[model samples]
Target: MAQAARLDIMSIAALVAFALTLGARTTFCEGISCGPGWEAFSSSCYKKMVDPNGWLGARFHCVLEGGDLVSFNSSAEEDFVKGKMGARSFWIGLSNLECNHKLCPQVSGKELKWSDNTLLNHSNWATVKVASTNLESCAYVLPNAHKDYHPGKWRKVSCESSLAYMCKRSPDGCQEGQPCNKTAGLALTPVQTSACDPGDFLRGHFCYRFENTKKTWQGAEDDCVLWGGHLASVHSREDGDWLIAHMEDNFHVGLKKNIKMFEWRDKTAMDPALWYPGYPSSDDCGRVSRTGQVYNHQCNSLIVFTCQKGVDVTHRHHQAHLVCAHLRSFSHPCSPAHSTSAAPRLE
Candidate 1:
């Protein structure tokens, strides 16, 4: 409550106008309340990001805000989205794509699921099947831009296509008549992660920890997320070498082999020479041996693993006034800026 009650001293009117056009005027809309920059419906919070970016970039933006690209569980959610989202094509979380060698290629049998890995139970496909290629495997919601185009329906397209997007998350705990700590620009009340948790080693922009307990690839990844990190990703040989030297045992990594190539779990560029020769021929998951050699393995196999998260994300604050239409710089682990490896010192 102490953190949520902190008021950063912005004019109430200004805060409302800047963040998604919601102010005190709409706080009680539909008998629900959300943070200053979000709208509430059903049991979740929604924000429409008008700035156009690629699907990956847009998802990262939502991640920085502690959410993910919007996922619809039912038609009611879909209809709710249709009413709030503007009449412009926007990226939703549904995709049958995976990052492979810097390209978003279609997986042979992957279904269009939400980014959080939820199976699609309901859909509003544009009533046509668009053949997916190496580049056209992502789905986007179409707006009423054309009389012939069906608004609120979805279509498959290239992940690289720049489009606006929507983000969804549980609402910040603020009821009507409560003081919302959020500010305009959806700063979302930046929280301080000044240091990694105890026993985690701070290195460069991330903290790394080797887990001794064996767990399946998906299990390891989920544990990392629960610990505020992910299975460690290697973007350079130096980082790979560090992992080889410091990590204690074989483990599942964030990289996964798909379509004959390996892609980093965070979707950063992968080092081409990190794999052991004759390895990674046709496995679904990735593991790094003690020698730093990358290998592909069955995703359901159990193994120890490593986790990594940004070292520190400085708290950000902006006041006075901010224009509502554009996105600010990303200052967290989800951004590519935090992906590089720096000199490591275990604490």
Candidate 2:
């Protein structure tokens, strides 16, 4: 009778433990749930920025909000975006300028790819023929006849043009103790100020380091890549000013001039404003002037160059967590049950 009573107590204890565990899990899920303004779909959350801006501006805006421009991985994703899009067009995170042949002017090749480097298996390009040119290389959504309500279709547009943009993020971004940005609809780790790794200087979420050790234009690019980054690409005047103010000497930027043409290492057009007056039309590499203006220098000229490493490592890590969580939620691995002997052997 005492043994049976003890057994009953153990069972009750087990039930209580299970209840506590289930409640804890439920609380955790609620804690990490997407906050206001962000629409939840699957394991991810998304938000659309209403203000129109240039492609780079839109991209930067999304980054500041702790996400990137939206990129669809499947038809369901595309459909979700369409539903959010309504009748208005917006920018999606799709472009080839970063990996296109325009970067290597000397190398003969024709390749257009996405900025995120997603493998190409699906696309919803517009049927209408739009002239393909370097000027309008960035991708955007256009109207299509697939469905009257879902008018979003894909096409290239000039990156300089202003347009509304969308962002996609995952809920796993909410690290422990981090408060959610309910207004932006992101449950993300607090956006920290740019911090550089040892031997690098923080510059607006990018870590920059000037290597006085001279190398050719291509050699500099290779070195930067080996160091896990690329040659610096100056975007805003503020960026250029910062580089000029911080550098003791003129340094090569990612820009390379071959023949009479100039392009960034990523094959994107270097903003003409970055060039010093009467610059270019020369066969050489690009260098930052003391005044922050850009000028062409001989490609073989051994000169100091700056490298820029991104501070988005956390974003990538959180994305990996989201992928893992999705897989685990949907998959059930086989669990071997413990075998019971027909009867305990008399010992």
Candidate 3:
């Protein structure tokens, strides 16, 4: 999420390449503090992003900043966010994109989820009752001060609507009992100040690092494995767009033609329909271009690649809650599975 702090990102399609160099920055930290422009509120730090973007794109920017789209877990939190928003509607981390009425609990018949993958325990919706359908939808908060809109109320909209967004992160900076120097202002990391590694970008609870160092597909995957992660895996259009936004040229991604289908090393299920145009399905490796197109590639070809790592317990627990909640909807008594099997690391 390093890129989010520096750019307004009103339109990622207009992004320009910029130079960024980092020294030896590693993952794992000890403490944190709210940086400039971030307000300390309750248990987290809040930052209002002044940019227009679709819900997914907005959330992507927040993840770049080492956070996710803001989640108002209570009425007070909702009011706090309303007070922070100026006149613009801001995208929140709430959605019902995966809601299947039969498999999940319904809020107005729509199951909402936060970007952090948590279920909605509280709501601040207006008259807009999102229609239950298979189509994706998101929620955004309207400023009450505006006479034309409902005050402190969330409105359902297509996830494609561009709007300003809010971000929240756990404060991290020099602190007592940690190997840190209070004198060193801002954040003490190898790269920038974020929840993930200083340099890695956070997306959907996963941390990704883009490496420009060209290496063969296998060599790239090996290096990522050496670093305790795996090659990057693209999950959706947003993921593909995110890669295009940060990268300037063609790069290798973590997928290979295994028999008749492409497989993600991390075990993420592939959506066959997501592959566009066509990937002759012949080459052994996968490559992505700045335009978000995938191609069949020779495994030994040298190219830059990305690496990905797992998230913390909070994120994992959120996933478990989602699955458990679904199972419970079927009347099956079950407990939340707090952990998951380790899969191949992805960049």
TM-score: which is higher, 2 or 3?
A: 3
How many backbone overlaps does candidate 2 show? 1
Error of 3 at 103 (Å): 20
Q: Is candidate 1 or candidate 2 better by lDDT?
A: 1
lDDT of 2 at 104: 11
Q: For model 1, how does the per-residue alpha-carbon lDDT over 104-126 read when each residue is reduced to its tens digit?
A: 22343345667755567877887
Off by over 4 Å in 1: 1-33, 98-109, 128-136, 172-347
Clashing pairs for model 1 are 205-311
RMSD of 3: 17.3
Error of 3 at 38 (Å): 1.3
Q: Among these predicted structures, which one has the highest TM-score?
A: 3
lDDT computed for candidate 2: 0.53
lDDT (Cα atoms) of all candidates against the true structure: 0.56, 0.53, 0.56
